[model samples]
Target: MEMQKMSNGSHHEYETLDKGIQPEEESFLPEKTDTGKKIQFNDFEGKTSFGMSAFNLSNAIMGSGILGLSYAMSNTGIVLFLILLTAIALLSSYSVHLLLRSAGVVGIRAYEQLGLRAFGQPGKILAGVIITLHNIGAMSSYLFIVKYELPLVIQAFLGQTSSSGDWFMNGNYLIVIVSVTTILPLALMKHLGYLGYTSGFSLTCMVFFLSSVIYKRFNIPCPLEAFGNFSNNATIPEDTCTAKFFTINQETAYTIPILAFAFVCHPEVLPIYTELYNPTKRRMQGIANVSILGMFVMYLLTAIFGYLTFYANTEAELLHTYSKVDPLDTLILCVRVAVLVAVTLTVPVVLFPIRRALLQLLFPEKAFSWIRHVAIAVCLLFCVNLLVILVPNIRDIFGIIGATTAPCLIFILPGLFYIRIVPIEQEPMSSRPKIQAACFTSMGFLFMTMSLTFIGMDWMSGEKRSGGGH
Candidate 1:
């Protein structure tokens, strides 16, 4: 037997969780002859029907990027941001639909699993490499945000001295603390579901934080009550609120772009479809609705809060805005703590998938062996910690990763998967026009290239010229 090469790259492991599901009786499938024909739609055993589907899409949507959404959207305008966010989120939900449809045809549990089954090891390797680069970078940025944001939170609530002034001290202990906070939770959890309650709690804290900021605005001298939950729309007059939803809503150009990127890409959503009880178009839509709407609300609230609170400040950034609001009370302190801990808790949840993927490639037959799993898991946690400590700033890293990964994973890859895999007769969208497929694929290719370029620039700027090269 030929040995399967791993060449998994930096991705530790992206596991295929035992969904423990019962097959829906209603699903369509082809039955084969007694000889060697084929049985189609053979029901998958042990799928996690709606377990992962219920993953607070709001939580997935509201994650690390959310902490910065306000700032990212700062210049984009409040109405613009909200309107764009809403439109973008809907697009993501649709992307998920297309991607899932492709997966169903391919008969894969995990999305990356498709890359392996369809394209072969090299394809898997390439996809893994791209995903790993993007994921690790993205995860690292989250760590960075926690490091800086948490301390300010700590000082504000506890009355301890703190400042963004000391660059050295900030980076040093900040990473250590973040690594400890993020890594510990990850190491302790045995299953993804184990962290479900914590994720829920974390999400609640986020909503609470938004509420606090909104309430605080009322207490401010000039409360921007008018800005509450108001999303923008280009169709309406820029300044008028009554006639339309919000005049300054998102631009049509970026709507597709943003939607292409924003709502989906949680990594866990794919499995949800596989595990669905009935796996009906109706059930799938329900799962998607819960998943997408949940996320949309979270993003919208956070974006709006940030806009109302920091729209005028020089920074207009989320964390910076929080600092300005400077709510040092016990309640506020607790709120910051909740946000810190919630974000920190999410690290392990994200890492688990990468670990699973690693196992499939490196040890195909013995994929689930505990020894290999533990060994790799420990090593990855250690490495992430090392990187967290080594890197100086989280925001810079965060920006780089978001710019690189967000486009493809969010807008581009899903589209590409649908375009390449699903036949028109199977899942036709003839009304939308095929140009969109071309556009999304091209965009993904371009963004993936951009991510590589950004990393290449980082390498060049960080390294010195070798004597022989000249």
Candidate 2:
């Protein structure tokens, strides 16, 4: 009655039930009854449809990253930003396809398991650590949104003046309330497939946020308009609403990494593939393509509209820029609330891979336990909440995580795994797959090095500016 760990870290007594059959072999064989007729397990069969899976994957891809895209556009300008975003989305979709092909070839479902099959325990640990760091960074960014935006939203709703020091007006207290009331319950789900409902709703909230941005693009007064006196004969600046198409500056290097972060949903890709109805490499890839394309459109529109509205003045977080204009504006308040809800719901979705990674690392031999699941979910939320409160700059968090772990997960690991796992006979040195893998791996490393260098330069320049001011 020895137990075996499933690819997802859940354990089942396969040795006792199947008389020492390996799980990979069992995956391909059909069950038969006493009368020799094939038996079916509809409950165990994949139940998620293409649309639902795409929605869930799309939700995973789109997060608080959208909030910073305008700032990204400011860095790279509109034309270059769009080009980089398109390239990143295409490369990301290709990376998912590589992972899917690797999984399909080995008949494995979980990402860590695929790593184990490729490079054994070290590979598994690498996959787990990358997933952990990438996901924790994501969850913290979402809560960071909650920490900064929710209090302003509460103030707008209650008509409370900014000078008030009420406990209810505290962002820390509001984020805690949101984490407890909204995020924790959803994070406790034992299976990733069950999150489709909330994921769909979360995506809807993001759509609402996008729509609000488009609406405000035309409605909100420009920065100069807010400062100008209407009774006097003051003319608005001619360049106030002009869009910048191209720019090169120190900040431009961060734009690609930020866009890469927007599309780093690889940790959830295999889990979603496993739950997909009639799961196949092609079908799961279709889901990834659809999800990535949808998010790409949403991101382009959000960045364009938000950037057009603010032009050169777009802040790192778009919502904060809105608050400065008029926190009490009804539509602006609604937009803030939509973004807050979107990010809050996103926290739980990001938690899935982190919990799965920890399970693989710590308790691979143990079966799924309700106590462990709840405790881990609570601890993760608490730790991320603390980080969100302590971290003052969201852009720095985004840049560090997006530059380092994101590229590794999105571009490097999948390509390297495919090259190693897929037989040399199937993909030789001259083969297209091998060439593509090499290109992907090289691009990832180049981007990682350049991003880190630019971020360091930005930090140094900021320090110089501060020292000069003093």
Candidate 3:
């Protein structure tokens, strides 16, 4: 069998394996060969079960983005948001198909390596930088959730107020504690597959949160007497509870970008594919579909219930909107705790790809080392904690990063990689696949341009609006 070169430092091993050796279920086993020499076969990469892989990918796909979705629904109204969201979800799955097809053609698992194969060194660098930036933003956003929400959770449990000077109530201190105690150890794991259990738990927590949102819709009366610090004397219009089927306004531009960013699990997709047991393009694509479909249901339910609960008054962060109706409510407190736990567990899953991308960029030829792995995890967590602690209300920064990188990951890079790496001889320029890939790439450019333009308008017009976090 002819072997394609791998750019992520596994070339030698794969090349050697190509010389008539096949990997199996065991980690390593020596095989008797015709040449009277034992051949060592390693199955280091394919240990993650199908179910666990789906859990991890599902955890990656669902993030703090879920919290912002209700706000997106509020802006676009019921009919429009559903249409846009379903479109984005389908497009996201198609994007994964493009990526898997590209990876299959080149026999490369790493996204950066696929880039290198597609466009050489520059391609590799672009993939590496985007992965780094996008994951960092994700990690920071997750930690920001911990920083802001964890304290509220603790406060609620302890029956204390935010004004309390206790260390647990301090978001900065609580975030560091969670990072060091919970996040650090899991992040130190050698492989992405090992985090699968935690990812499963994280998904469960989010499910609890979604269930709570659905339940609360029936319990909490609309046209709330008081919203946060707003006066109870303020009268909300009676129509505030009415759902809008279709709407258009300045805020309408944010709906697509919000939904686009919500579906960004591209960085995690290739890594999970590499670790899947009995890995195949079809198998990985199935995992992606299952995960995406699961999240689609969760996202749709969360948005519909959350929007129905608040109607026009839904805040960008769904949890915060809940606080407006008695922050000390036991059910709401549990929901907050669930969200905190979910986001905390997801950080390590997001961090793995960033570290892998870094290792690929900085030490492509070097073998994996414990020292390097632990160090990368530590550094990433520390930097993210700093961003959460030191950077006050810097979500706009991450918002911009998400706007730029999310679409690239979701649409542009996959489409471009497919267009460039899939040989013209196999699929000619005028072929349907190539034409579709070209169109996919164009759509990404359009998404990025529109997202940035709206965001720029917000900044230029001095409107510090809250839509959703990417």
Candidate 4:
């Protein structure tokens, strides 16, 4: 619900096959195991039961970025699109269950602790790095989107050309403004307990963003035409949603690498689950169901609306989705600004961990204080600024971060942690966890390989098209 915070970082332990391995179902079945040491948070004064705290963690996790998910799914094709969305959702939910199980058995409150418990010191450090980098990538992308979209709307309203180099439009310049406006409020505030109501604001923005697209498409007098009917023979559109993009043919080789990037957020889930005080089996199940269901619906709605709004003309710069529609559409513009700001503000919240980890690793004896918080905030701002300047294209920025780092957070680290330390180490099924972890590692490795290949190829392709050739 809240956008900003001061002086905090969280480690999320997750892993993928650092190649293409899948989570094996065999590992999840219970086995005779050591009852873990009772673990409890020291700050338990305002502890919330698992069922009690739906406030905004899931809502935060299910944010404006997900609104664009359906469009991404559409690129995969109706069948593959649905399949990928469903598969990723199920896997993501299962990942939460695995994380919860890991915590319950190890008495580890933070995700890093689970990594350390399972994989030794190296494991903990590795997990921390993955989560940190993945989040950094995420935050930077958000900054780019906010800086890029919001000012363009303002300029459009003023009937002035947006200067790409202008102070208001430059990615880094906008980062400073948005970060200060958004993050400063959150950082200055304490008592995050009361922020549940903020999720309502975010939820409203999300709802309006979708409804605007739906309304506009329908008002055009043919809502179904927005999707352009499922054609059996017509040549597909040239833009992303064109049917040609979804093939099991040669292009399939190119897609698997991006899969690693798209399927992440595993690290963030455990912290939310751990905060669920003394959860029962049923309560935990409820949290998982609610979180997953909310995410699924948001992703599906946003993606479909994005595709319809953009249709065959969807550009790599998704801001066009808003710009192409009449600029005078006041409701749509409001929705755009709200969603953009929400996504932008999330950067500081996500980045809180890396700053903390860096501090802990570099200076362990110090107390958390105003000076420390300011220093970390400044450092993170610098990092974000550098990213915004270097990576001007928000989509490409996401690809870099999501492809290069997200897999580490999502699949490889979590999988490795589960396999390395099973609660039922005495049982034969404990071996299954190792296999499952190996699969996750394989997935990560596959992603790394593909990311390098595609990035290199994508870069080369851009060069070829730009230098006096078509």
Candidate 5:
């Protein structure tokens, strides 16, 4: 029996495989019966349900990025931000459709395999690299949340003041403790399917976070009495509760990339699809739709309520804004804990794609080993913890990763893969699919160019502010 490697480095053997099967007819099939009836593949045996798959994907899509949406809304205003967000959601859903269609047509379940089929080794390597970087950035963001919020949660629980220099209260120490005790164990799991439970819990935490934001929106007063206590010397805006309907400035461009970063679950999509029971293009697409739509509603509500709550004073990270208002408030403390738990749980989900990408690139021939898995998980968490401790600005990290790899994964690669994988004869020159692919590719380029330009502008403006202060 000949063996072929699956995306996760496991071998699958097929008896009497057909070598002459065309790409279009290579759909996944179960073993043939004595009468030659094609039976459906039940490899999973219905272990994973549709709800679990949707929850996993939803957890992947909603991460630390949700915390920044209010800040993005503040930059672009209510009208423009909602419009931009809706457009991005629709575009992201379409891109996923393109990717799944290409994979289904070729019967390739992994993103790297699709890349390998499209452009040989270079394509595979490119996909792996992008996945690694994007997911690393995501993991770092989750750890960043831990770094900043964990300390506050601990202090709230202990009723300790911020002025205390207790070593136990140090953010870095707390992060290390949490990583070793909680995140490391979760990250060491062998299969992505096992994470469905944790993913569901993680998503629940985010939902609580959304609910808390909405509740606080009505509870908090304008010109925030909380901010007065935190910043005694700073001037407070008189009309902080009123939302901005429309606005554009140097900072507005940064919001586009931030929003782009929020919708990136492309790397995790195929892995979930492969493990799905009775996986088909239509079924997987349904999973994608449910996941994206759920996240879209959550993101919108979070952004709108967050922005409305603090309006002019909305900080890049919503938790920070809440901290300044009343760190000791019971509801605020609960929300902080929820956000912290949510991000902690999310770190493992994000790490799966990164580990898989590394295996694909560096250890393609190697079988899945627990030793290697634990070591990689440990090493990655260690490095991300260091980055979280050292990197003071989350926005800068978001900008750089969102500007570069996010676009490539979300837009460019998918469109290019579809164009290359679908036969020219099947999608003729004037075909709508071909035309849409071209338009999608063009949009990816435009997003990449704009993201870079805005990042540069943000950097320059920061330099100017530093120079002026000096």
Candidate 6:
């Protein structure tokens, strides 16, 4: 009896083993059949340690969503926002559990492959399209940050205003420069494991941003009125400083979708799991748990402090709200630079899943090719840069995509995949887990419907708002 490793890149048809795999590889090994033969498949040989994997996943979770969370908290109030945040974090963890379980049952690591396992070619196509669209939206949003914020950071550093008319201050030219120099190189890496260090650096930048937010809350005085002229200040109002426990308003409809959008890291989950060293369902799940929990705490603190500082004047984007107070403040300028660095590094991490999904859909049988990989990365960045540059208002496009895709990735697909992929004999329809999965799927549809309805109402009313800080 011996264990065999096949180098073919095909997604289907595992190489069945006549005997057991080595103990180190046992975590990902398939269960032995009645014939006592083990089943194994070709996967990217994982090299990332547990910590780096967690960092990569955490960076994926932390996006422009953090910026909008403060605004969401402003509408929902402190207590209610905490409830929604806690519930969504727990549900996101559960969804990852479902994905891990489904993958383990069939020894399929790629998300699109899991889709193919469940339904057919159509499932694979649907999964691929959703992943592509979702990540495209994500990449566009990150570049949008570069397009808008990088200019401001430069202006602050140079002590020049936007009216300078200098090419260095032009956002369009700056985004292109950053993409060619920074983002494109990182995106060209051969494996997701290689990005672990960049991901760690990105998260560190975010921690600095979060720390700055907390610091500003204490330093910035209350009743902070009259921004255009800093010399004029109003007296403090006791009522304005007080925190609200619960509240409801027309803007309340946007809160859930915003929170949901913040947690849409599902596309990256399986891929990170694929590259994790000594990977197991539990260890990957631990990675997810640690990453989610860390982001949850960071999100919670950022929202609470940001909203507390601005109170009624909080804008849809927390950083923008800070800008209205004092645009040239040194610490705030540094915070902007930190945020720019974080999101810039994150573009590559987000780009990996999109590139992988495209490969799965377009070239499932092909082995790793540098020509194809580099071409895809270059093409994707070019398209996203075009989208960011050409579109006058990306927030509206971002709104529509977030409303449709975020819930699907977060709630709908995982629930549907688990129910479809898991064997009926192993866990029947009437079983507790199956029933829970069904309910989870139904909840996704409900969330999608509610988000669209509210966003539609806002459109009809002609009220402009940020799409969860996209």
Model 4 misplacement above 4 A: 1-39, 44-55, 63-70, 159-172, 188-195, 221-263, 277-285, 308-311, 317-319, 363-370, 389-398, 429-434, 463-470
lDDT of 6 at 61: 94
lDDT, each prediction? 0.54, 0.77, 0.84, 0.55, 0.78, 0.85
lDDT for each residue of candidate 5 in 56-90, tens digit (9 for 90 to 100):
89988887778878888888899999899899989
Specify the poorest-scoring 10-residue window by lDDT in model 6.
18-27
lDDT of 2 by residue, 253-287 (tens): 65766677778899999777766777766788899
| Per-residue accuracy of model 1 over 1-470 as CA lDDT, tens digit each | 01111345212222222233212221222233345433323234324346454653344455555555554454456566666776666666676766666565544445576666546677567556556655566556557667667667655645666564654346557756656655654545555555556667777777787777667555543322333433443243343321122333322222223333455354656534444454544566677778677777766676666555545341423554444444465656666677777667666666666675666557654524566666766777677767877766554454455556667566566676666555565446663634576666676676556545644555678741110000
Report the error of model 2 at residue 286, Å.
Answer: 1.0
Q: How close is each model in CA RMSD to the real structure?
A: 9.8, 5.5, 4.7, 8.9, 4.9, 3.8
Residue-level error in angstroms, candidate 2, position 133: 1.2
Better of 2 and 4 by lDDT: 2
Model 1: runs farther than 4 Å from truth?
A: 1-52, 72-74, 156-158, 162-182, 185-190, 223-266, 272-285, 314-316, 325-329, 394-400, 423-436, 443-470
- The true-versus-predicted C-alpha distance at residue 295 of model 2, in Å, is 0.4
lDDT of 6 by residue, 1-470 (tens): 23345556474545436435432243455445456755335555677899999999999999987988888888899999999999999999999999988887666788899889898999998898888888999999888889889888887888876547889888888889999999999999998988999999999999999999999999999767643323445445555767787878877777888887788899999989888876779999999999999999999999999989988778888888888888788999998899999999999999999999999999998888999999999999999998888897877777778778888898898999999987686788999999999999999999989888877887898987544743
Arranged by lDDT with the best first, the candidates are 6, 3, 5, 2, 4, 1
Candidate 3 local lDDT, 1-470, one digit each (tens): 23433445463234434533332222221234466543321225478999999999999999787998888888888999889988989999999999988876656678898889889999999999999999999888888888877777776777776558877688999889999999999999998999999999999998999999989999998667765333577665667779998988877787888888888999999889877777777789999999999999999999999999999889888888888788788888888888888988999999999999999899887777999999999998998898889989886788688888998899999999999977786788899999999999999999999988887888899896755665
TM-score of 4: 0.74
TM-score to true structure, per model: 0.71, 0.86, 0.91, 0.74, 0.87, 0.92
Error of 6 at 455 (Å): 2.1
Error of 1 at 378 (Å): 1.7
- Write the number of the candidate with greater lDDT, choosing between 3 and 5: 3
Number of backbone collisions per candidate:
23, 0, 0, 28, 0, 0
Better of 2 and 3 by lDDT: 3
Better of 4 and 5 by lDDT: 5
